[model samples]
Target: MSLLSKADEAKLKGQLQDAVISCTERCLYSSAKWAAELLNSFPETDDDGSETDVDSAMSDPPPPQTPTPSSKDPIEARLEARETQKYLLAKTFFDCREFDRCAAIFLPDSLPKTSFLVTPSPASKSKPHGKSKIKLGTPTKPALSAAVVKGLSQKALFLSLYAKYIAGERRMNEDSEMILGPQDGITTNKELPGISAILEEWFSGLANSGRKPQGWLEYLYGLVLAKGKNEKQALEYFIQSVNCCPYNWGAWQELSTLFSTIEELHQVTPQLPQNIMGFVFQIYASQELYQSANQVHNSLAQILDIFPGSAFLQTQRALLYYHSKAYEDAEQIFSELLVANPHRIDAMDCYSNVLYVLENRPKLAFLAQLAMTTDKFRPETCCVVGNYYSSKSEHEKAVIYFRRALTLDRTFLSAWTLMGHEFIEMKNTHAAIESYRRAVDVNRKDYRAWYGLGQAYEVLEMHSYAIFYYQRAAALRPYDPKMWHALGACFGKVGKVANGIRAYKRALVAGSFYDNNVGSSFGSGEVSGLGGGVLDPEVLFNIALLYERVNNMGECAAYMELVLAQEEGPDYDESVGDMAGGVGVTPTTSKARLWLAKWEYMRGMYQRSMELANELCQDGVEVEDAKALIRDIRARIESQKGDSSVA
Candidate 1:
């Protein structure tokens, strides 16, 4: 029983003839029966050893064994040999990295013969009448060459150990034994890498390797590449990986993230699942990647054409429409979704928001109520209800709802501010002030709250407090003329006249006009040199008269002009006429004319002034005093004429 085939022996001797090949004394002749079985499966050789019956030889059963007398039977001996040969061939294929071929060998020829073992029925001597006796051949021992047995055993051991390694059960010691054992048949020096390590190395190599790999290896490689810093490289790898392995979720996830990070999401549109369309919409919505989002939306529509009953896809389409601001489409879809699933919270919120934005207040209110019924604790629903009440001027109801919203979300600043506004509208100044204070406490930099607080204090006549808030508001918004004017008025109320004037100057600098309600006007209680009161016609006239006394002719004329502009025809006559008569002028006469005459005379309009004085003299106005004043004006005019001539 030779341990090696004659060919294998000759090859070994030839290798030893070359001094470069050396084997230690421990190197025993381990048969390569498994290697021979694999080689035989390749094809049969011709007389010249060229493959002649290639396909047929590969399909042939294992070689026949020399039967011995001890064997059970000829059939049993041949069957045993065939089974041994099949095991050896499987082992050899596995060692050669031909896993597909190894798997194929294990497949049964037919369904019923698929079991690994074959059972034989017992022979019976009973026969029909007149049947002759039949004798069975004696069983014989299967004469397997020692070399083939050793090789087959080694191969079987290697395969068993490899299976354990692949199943993640082989210990490091077991792997080391398989690699370093004398009977270990694999030529590679390294222990068979663990499945995970092999997978990792294969992934790394495919990711860095220019050539493309296929199957799960390609998909895993793409995942590794996608995580790498080089995005372009990752993109290329991901495309290849997904193409190779479409079922790999890792590849899909990495592709999604990669496209999202670079914002080149169009690259992933074709591959995105309908289930993740909503996620895709969210990414584009956040980044404002409209074109890519639209493509994805279109893709979803295509998928829906194929799978129209997909509820999840319909929801995603609705969200896309919402993001695109196609409110009509969104409303339609959400309405459908709500009808289908009555308790859809997100759909309710989205539909409500759309209505709110569209200014369909009643519809928004209805939706908000429904949403509240669905989830009483939802703050957004409460906020929507508050907005509805606020729009209707139901300040009390608005306040209650806004407060409820605050209870749900303590940090809701807009709710707090809206609550303050409602209190203000309700004329609850103290409560308004407290609400604004709370808003400011929540957000110290809220300029609107500071302004609101200032207005509340102003309304309460708390001048100093008002000034404090007004200054804060002004500091936050220096360009606001209203704040400047309010600060000026507050200062004036507290008798800080100089400060008040400065504040007014600031208002003017900020482009405030001093007409009626703004800047140093008696109108609207913003008067200089006067107490808080409505503008009085007589007092204004007196102020004009005082301006005349102080030689401020321009100011005096301005005041008179304002009076004339306000006083209309006969009413002006009656008012001015009564005042003049009290000062000794006739009733029904125009006193502003007389004042104008005096002003004209002082302004060197002597001829015009004399004409006015003469008219008054002829009317018997102010009787004795009018005539004397007219004579004095006439004489003074003549003296001015003489001086002009001399000049």
Candidate 2:
């Protein structure tokens, strides 16, 4: 090579490094590829007789030489040294996990000043003419070489493909964060299969070239497959990654997550770096493996020295505490995080949850409103606002927020269910039914939705439909007394006496009629308005009527007595009870007591019936009927005495 050529090559290599650095810092993939083109302008000649010595190439550079007598030129060796260094620097950045930096060098738009060695635009190339034309004072630019054009194109293609693949892996975290509603519209156009195919092609090329993929390459390929939902295939590469480099924390984390049990991960846990233990802890905490979660957290805590001033770590610790139901600890940690960065939306979201669990609605609402003002589009903020309105019994306002939340994320099952509840509170049975059905459609496992559906149907007097929904709800929550009670009432309405009686008995045995263990995404807390009379007096009354239908007067009388006793007790507070859905429970009044008196007479308990009738008359209820019954009984008694005397 000539001195002029060697000098030009060295300058071009330096420009390539600058472009790479600039593009990488900005994460400009396409521009970085263009930068890579400048470095790849010249081909490196490999000796077929010997293996390529990558280490020697990276460590040593040819010294500047004087003129030599041999055919081998000193300038050529200098040119080769610049080429090797340029290539190695790219690889070094990639291996250091500075991918954006490495990628920037390969992008097309990253060039600060165009180099003569880079591929030139076809429009910029001037065609030869038979006659020379007069030129101005401008300097002439050199024409691009065919080899340089082809090499740049080849390098650019590979780099662009690699950048696209990296973008795909990045989308995994983006998709996760989107579902979490921390930000909006972070989704990219790259599909998983397309990216995976590109990665496989690149990896295959490396392997075919007698080179193994780097640890990060394998780890990123595994991420693509994992994101593509090919976990089984991903696992192989993930294992290969850690095998290639045990310090690959990402590989370790992915492997740890795939392990079904905490015991399965124990083998690698001790080998995990302290910084990576946070990811392992997240896995355990998310899966509710509390024992393993606690162990991992304690180990991480020791490593972080209790995270004295790191708000991020402190917030994570608080969430773990919240998951473990150490609400007070969670509250304190969240408070500290908020104090450090009071405008932190996530901290506010979590702090609101802590307040909700403590039933501090005012504070919960305050935090929720603040969070909403910060990020109105976030589903958690919408939910917090909705929940506050619900607590205040401003159900219409609550529904608006709940619907807004659902609009943000339709798959938010809790929002759907809560919306149904708001409709029910408004007594809009049809709308409630539709909302509850949507909840069930979103998640059939949500028992609250099923119960809401049942209640809505029951209100509309669609007894058969009510029975169907109640039965479904009961199946999911077999121990829920309210479900069984509602089922029994529906059966009675549809004239299924035997089924009604069976369901009523089940209701009685199911313990409390109210479900206090209401679960929510934020956390579990007490539910209100579902409790009034724990043992519904109306259910007993329905069972009594069902027995009376079969002339089982003894059982009927027994149940009627239970109803009366309940009505008279403090446990059966009438003020809180709502019998809006034709729940078959009537307020205990003169009419209810009179029905007991009539049933006693029908059972042939004449003397007992007479006593009850007399008491009813004295209480100034059904006086005419009680008096007429007494007169008839007295006449019958006199007739019987006369007959006995004759005999």
Candidate 3:
């Protein structure tokens, strides 16, 4: 057997580890299992620590000459020792969702310690105590202790801590309702007391060490810091996590949820490392920001240029279109992805969402059936089924599937939001509000939940509270005209004319942007003046009404003119003897015309006023108001004629 050089051995192990990580990231568990088997093929090194043992298995069976200590890599030896440990098995268990089994593998004295760390001696029968480290030949079981867990690789340490955390959560879930009652959200729970002890004792002195924390260790520490509400420290550790593991999407996703506002995101942007991880993190941040579609699209284009084949990136692009309410484009992209990989259920939930919005019943039903056939247990599958039911207006059945999704994953944000939508449909306002609140708790960036909350409050006639929620939704999704329109409506409901006017102006701007081209990307422009579009006749009319409220007659008259110019509705066909058979004029158009007539009469433009009033009456719409206005104009014209004759 020929002994491999230390550098060669380390490089080989790194290659194997990278393969496993890549497979796992793609959720290719079977491939990961095969890779793990290949890893296991490399024989475990004995406590004596020799490259000969591992090399012997891979190469010739003949004995090899021992290399001198000076030629050995310390990292190589550490890597060998870790192979002898059960972390690999623990990791496998972690992937299988066997949290308790995974935790057990890392439990105290669980795995056999290799000869390098432990040696049996008849004289050293006693256990080592504090104040002194174990000497070379101490006879102790292969047990880990409070003072002994140091210098672990980030993955190793994170695995141990995270396993315990998951196990603790699973244990709590058995009787979660009894253990933690209603006020506590499912996404949050009390600290696992033992976790604190493990951090303080098992990871003793780690915080005090001079070494910078590795990514996963920093992630673990950040969890503790975040739980403590020590946001400053948590932010620092999370920043370190991304810096150290630039490709760690999970860490970036976690970091993305830490902030609730754009102001907070900007405050921390300078502190983030500006590498690919930070670049991707900014993209994640934008999902919540709801910036202009063009701006978001451009940023995504830069990343997609680097990784054109990434399904995750493509799904995000699809999501951008969905958020912009460009359902057709989003649906096309999602359909293409599914056609390429029919069994892939990754984002089918979102695809179903597009179908639901389009009311493509057949497509939605087909997706739900296919998703169920692929893997009914997945939360995405459940969501697709839920969406199918939702599209059918089967609110009760839809809620059940959405509930199942949440049961599978408490942090399933889409399930929570969708469930709230169903509750709203069923007129269960309180339940809808609660579900939306939980969605917000899971991810503050969920503008859907905020918008839902506003809708729920509005249904309850809580205008002030609805305003607060709508404002939050508007702030996050500034480019969404629906949010601006909502804010305008709510502001007007509360008698805030000036505020309502400003909000309507913004609504006009956003609506114009959406109407011009749903594909265009741009930030929400400031709005002192009104924007024109078919998207905003209602908004224009609202603005004109608000102006009238404040008695700004000139602005009111101008906006009213714009409203009439925009409405362009087909007048009711009173000529058809049966009114119901006529092409109906929308009430909005009728009211706008009435307002113009009143304005014209006040300006002594009696001819124009009578023309409009007569048009309204002849259309068989708003006849009573039109007749009254016509009478007043007649009286005024007669008075003017009488005065003229006197003159």
Candidate 4:
């Protein structure tokens, strides 16, 4: 397509380089003291030193040889100016939403490989390495110098690629919710438009040139591969990226997304540079998986000694508490964060969640209004608004706001999960499942979405499917009692008694360890309609019920006794169990007493049954059943006495 052939283009680029070098050398020649510095920078020559004359020397009169104002290298100064100009122009185009123009300024997709960005230098072909020779041809490296190239690579590369990616997403502003994310989910990234083809060809060109990608390019490549769902290759490139430039949080974020399980994370974590940034990545990963609460707590504690003022580290701490169901602790941190940095909106969505859970509607509404006033269109602000509506039971409006957040950024994982929650509240199980699936698609490490899908499936009575989903969530948050508890319930519903018992036991151990190591996540006898079950009296009662299901009366009675004993204290009365905030057995007390009484009666312990039934009767719980039980016991005793007298 070019008028010149490859040979002519190479010769032209060489001539241009010579002019730039000659102009640079002539400027130094004006300062005789600097003339010697230009010798090493000149082009290679023949052995006899009879070489091509400098292009400007062949002219009759020389152009002005004045040194630059700063006494800087004229060529280098020009490159700096050009770099800045191009970057500012590209940034302006991006701000104006001219995404294609913004990207083309750096990485033009419409043209052939014959652009100003890349020029093959004949001198660089077939470089020697020991006795071997490595041929590097047609490199993707730009003609810019090391310093100029580094400056441009920092901002232009990421921004330009990000622009291209957004364009390739093929989004239309008017697209409906159903169109943005279908029933299957937003798995359309692999179907990116022509930009993807162009990028692929360019990447191939880099590979063919025998030059590995730069750190930033590797990061971009990983992002593209991740978007296309080539996770394994994406992971390798991400690792390479961090090795090349370990301080880039952007690369770490993309790298962390590929890990769906803690095992995968653990395996890859050692390979990552264990610098300060890598430690931050570990904390971030812990928050995402919700598994290593202890690591999040202790590791963040140590790191905060170095960066105590970092709001991000503080939010990770709050999130750790949130995942552990320690809402009060989490709320305190969030409140402190907002007070210290009033303009911060990074974790407002999480703060809103804590408020919503605590049912502090006034604070929630205030937060919503504050965020809306600050930046109403941010995904976090939209989520806060959505939570506000959700707290008010405005399910439809909440969903609309959540959808708006997703429309702005579909990769906003919280929006997808929260929208699914709204759908679940509206009792639209199918829609909820779709939303949750989309969340998982965006980041499989988001255990909340997996758990939400499980809950939705559970609501639909699809116990088998619910178990599968719950297991996925539990794997991410292995220490989370709620996830294990959900899995146990699903197993029970599916008639997998042994698996149910094992899952319930995991819930019990997880809860105990959590309380011991991470503080009491859920306080004693506390029941949250929104929370997953823990190793409280409720779990004990479930274990008892399951044991009774399998006809294991001994274990059933043992667990029932444990359930009631937790409520028993020196100040507690038998009648205090059902009282709110009581030291007694609490809301599940009556159920446990009824089961224990029935078990006693079955085991011929009629007197124990009578005492328990009498307590239930006095407590005004199971009154009718208690009366019938008392009558039957009394009648049986009279009949037994008659038989004894007859004998």
Candidate 5:
């Protein structure tokens, strides 16, 4: 026997038959008018038929078949047929919106009778041949209207198909096939033709209907299209929405975002809403879209009819100018901001920087002081104040501020470095070294910290440590001539003469002139060993001394000659005047002239040497040793010439 009982199987068969009959009748009725319309619209050709042929085709007769009820009651078959006809009529009337007629069809008098039966197959001997079964009472109709029933059934079928599609049943083949298939002999295009036109028509209808879309639906729909599948359609929708609601910030915001995504913000920046101008400005600023940002700023300024008084905006504009190296313009704006808002820490900080750029240390100090009054706890402000004092050579005060800055923020490397410099100026070598080491620890890349450490070590006679720091500084700032010069000096202090020479050459190439760091460069100071300071005379003399120490005697003599030629006064008179003032004293001009004479005589230039000696003797100011040496030289010249003008 089958898994289902015979009675159950019969009941299920009866329901299935009823459903099939109902569906067929509805399909036939709906198709009738649609088919007629298709036939009327069908084209006539020689190969096909004329209008009369089409009309005849529509009116063609169907051959009748004799109704048969096999093994079932005749009343049951007739009732089922009548029920199917009622179902179809109700569906048609409901589709045409004839609700009353549709409701009457599914009333209590119209339902079909249901029956149960048991039957045995020809191959199954265990079951009886057949047993007819029928309900004794008439069937009761559903209270709901036939229109509602038809709609519910259609809705259920559509839902089932949608669920299957979502579940990936048949791989989307079912939906695609049915949607593309012909309906009522009318062929449907596979791909949507004129979809754009359809959408335009829908939009036009919406506009003409004057129905306001609720909430942000209209905006959201436009936004989806704008960012989703069709940007042009989305734009049209957005424009319509904007026309409907001019103050809609959402539409404007979405439209602005769309412009940014496509990098066409320049075109849309002017169209942004005034209320959300800040957000638009932020986006442009983040992207570093300066030209567009400026344009937007101008437009916003006009719209608001007021300049932004926010210190932040002023600082931002100032920073842009600073980055472009427009120091004057940056200074003007920064100063204005500081004046307007005295408590703006950033403005004060930037003002200090601008003053530094202008080389106005006094102004920098003033701004730094102003900043400190507002925020005395700020380490950067304290450091700036310390820098100002340090530049003025007020090491004690500089140290106080620097130490205070470091106390507030121990990681402030600039303050640490400034403190180290103060110690160096005060000749506290060990303290300077400690401070510089702390700076290096705070910021390993601080080249000035390493250089200060080197100088402090050199002052303490720790040549090796000095050399190490100098090397590190050189590595950090290889292009700095001062670093090269410092390295050379460190090498020289450590007795590395050859290395020192090489370093000096590097310093020369790096643009460190001999007089750059010397005392004479600032005047009123004594330069030991070289005998002159920063003056041209001192530099030439130092060059001569260095050459002589290196055993370049000819070079030493040549530089000495250059010095003598450039001297403003007579050599002997200048020597006398220097002696009276206790400055640049030479033992005797006669002796120096005699040495020069002997040097020229040895080089076979006797006439030149004799003339130099004569000029020296003619000055009438000679020492006893110089006079005796001159007498002996005159007797020797008389003997060589055999003149016999005996002395």
Candidate 6:
């Protein structure tokens, strides 16, 4: 008959409770006003007419007038009592912040009824005439007046929406999302529930009502969308949240993460939590916004005062200092942390890295020894020792440390990867491959291990295996140029000329991209000439040969010239022997020049070929081959001129 009546029927039928609450909320501006109106609306009929009792309306307890056992009408009083009880129950649930229970209470019949709410069928009674009598108790249900319904409406809707937002946030983590940088690898996926659909329903309901959701609701939705990789939607929600409540720190945190510049973060809120400040620094560092990162790091002391004894915050602060070239500050903080807790192997490793960068060899050695004293069998401690020796060009000692690390913990992924690197340095391809295999077994997503495998297989001339390993590495780190180059080389070895050409092209693009993109202090670039993931000019020379094999003479000559030009560049020297991550390798410049000379002679550029050959000989790189090429070119030129000249 009425909207309130319909809502009651819907509740009994276990449907439209959310809709009912939403509609009720639209009618009431605030819960307190609704409560006062609800209590005042109850009227009593006197001798002349109906009158409201102000005292009864003002107080939550029923009127002072007592209805005796033989009172005139009790139905209204019973309804009033029932409504008051239900309203109190709803209020209790809201007070406890158990919004889900409130939603469930309002929509109790929506799902299976609990045993307590179900009427039990009475036990059958046997009679003398073989007849059984059966009985069933009527199930009791709570009833609420329109006043009580309207009073609880706002809270019900708020709780329902809040619960849905929380559910969606939790489910979003199940989707495709990555936590850290490329090195952290991909996250595992979980089976999602119906949270996304619930969130959508909540939004749809709010939109239909033509009302903006609460500030916290917007924040939660933003976090959910962000976890789901819907950055644009997440950004919109985060902005809306901040616009609604500038003091919402959670919204500011999410907004800070989605934004690119410090200005965007400041727009969210100038005052941030220590953890949020740390996040800001990391974002700036990642985008190579060093100036901004340093600015934020400078405020670390003040932020730390608010969040005392947070090791994570302190460690991030130290890393920021390191990136800003405040190495002394970084080193000091790291030293303090390590001294406070000597078993902090990570701190020891980091401090050692900072010392290495500063070229403070004595301090680095002392840190390494301190690490050893803390835990000789710790994987990270051993790694620190190994990396130190490796840096000093002491391959044998590095191998011993790496081996000791593995012996202590075979499943240590870093040790396995680095040990393979050591083996590669020692020219033991077989041992390197085995170590890499173990690393892969420990963590298949480790790109470094895959790259090591690619190097070992390439050395053994197992081109197919090399291709597989390099492909894995490339999949994990698509930005790594060396992986693509190695893949191209393998393809060329397997006689897949077209594929080789494509891979080489990708390698060039990726290499240029890497050169332009700066990295964080903790990036792979920190340790130069140590990892296989580095630029290699030899890739250009190899690509040139691949072009030659395919008979693309123009492309072959163009690539050869590119190689020579690149070698002449200052940055080319840094990439000289990085290919295959091996030791004792000569620069590829000489070989590339010699190949270019031969290519020129084949293309009938005798004079140009002669110049390159003579230059190579004078430079004393591949001297014998260059001399032979020069003699042959001279002979060919004489014959062409009909001089018939000979030595």
Computed on alpha carbons, the lDDT of every model, listed in order, comes to 0.50, 0.59, 0.70, 0.69, 0.50, 0.57
Which one wins by TM-score: 2 or 5?
2
Candidate 6 deviant stretches above 4 angstroms: 1-344, 350-363, 375-377, 388-411, 423-438, 441-445, 513-536, 570-587, 643-647
How well is each residue in 1-647 modelled by candidate 1, as lDDT tens digits?
A: 11345565344333222211111110111112212211222212344354557687664643323222114334434444656777667656656655434534532112331122543334432432333322232112223333332222222322433333322222322333421144322222122333224335444544443433333344433433433345576666666654643333344445554542324564555554433223434343333222224556666655454335445456667755654445677678877877776654543544654554455687777767777788877766676677677667677887888777766655456666667777778898887787787677545545557878987888888889989998877775454445666787677678675566566556545432212212210012222211122122333354455566557878767765444433332223563453321222223233544676677777778777777667667666644555565777879978978999999
Q: Quick one: best lDDT, which candidate?
A: 3
Q: Compared to the true structure, candidate 2 yields what TM-score? A: 0.45
Clashes of each: 5, 14, 3, 0, 3, 0
lDDT (10s digit) by residue, model 6, range 1-647: 11234334223222222222322332212322322322222222242253546576543532223222112224423433545555456546645656446445543423323344555455322222232222232222223233433333333433444443433333333332321124222432121123344445556666544343445456656766776778789888877765643334345545655654435555544333333323434343333222324446555554454334445456767765654446777888887777665666754555665766566677778778888887887877987887788668688898888777765655567677777887888899887887788787656656678888988988888889889989988776565566777788789889999899888778766654432223322224221121233334566677778888878888877777766665434333455643233322235767777888998898899888888888887777799998998889888877877864443
- Assess the local accuracy of residue 439 in candidate 6 as a C-alpha lDDT between 0 and 100: 84
Error of 1 at 102 (Å): 52
lDDT of 3 by residue, 161-223 (tens): 777777656654553552114633643333344555556554457556543444656666677
- What lDDT is obtained when candidate 2 is compared to the true structure? 0.59
- For candidate 5, the TM-score is 0.36
Per-residue accuracy of model 4 over 243-340 as CA lDDT, tens digit each: 86554456777887877776788999878887655777888887777754565688888766544566777888998888877788899999999988
Q: After superposition, how far is residue 365 of candidate 4 from its true place, in Å?
A: 1.3
Worst 10 residues of 6 by lDDT: 522-531
What ranges in model 4 sit over 4 Å off? Answer: 1-88, 106-160, 170-213, 291-295, 513-535, 569-587
**Local distance difference test, candidate 5:** 0.50
Between prediction 5 and prediction 6, the one with superior lDDT is: 6
| TM-score sort, best first | 3, 4, 2, 6, 5, 1
- Please name the candidate that would achieve the greatest TM-score relative to the true structure: 3
TM-score of each: 0.29, 0.45, 0.75, 0.73, 0.36, 0.45
RMSD (CA, Å), candidate 6 to true, equals: 19.0
lDDT for position 76 in model 1:
31
User: Candidate 5 — which residues are off by over 4 angstroms?
Assistant: 1-361, 388-394, 512-544, 557-647
Quote model 4's TM-score. 0.73
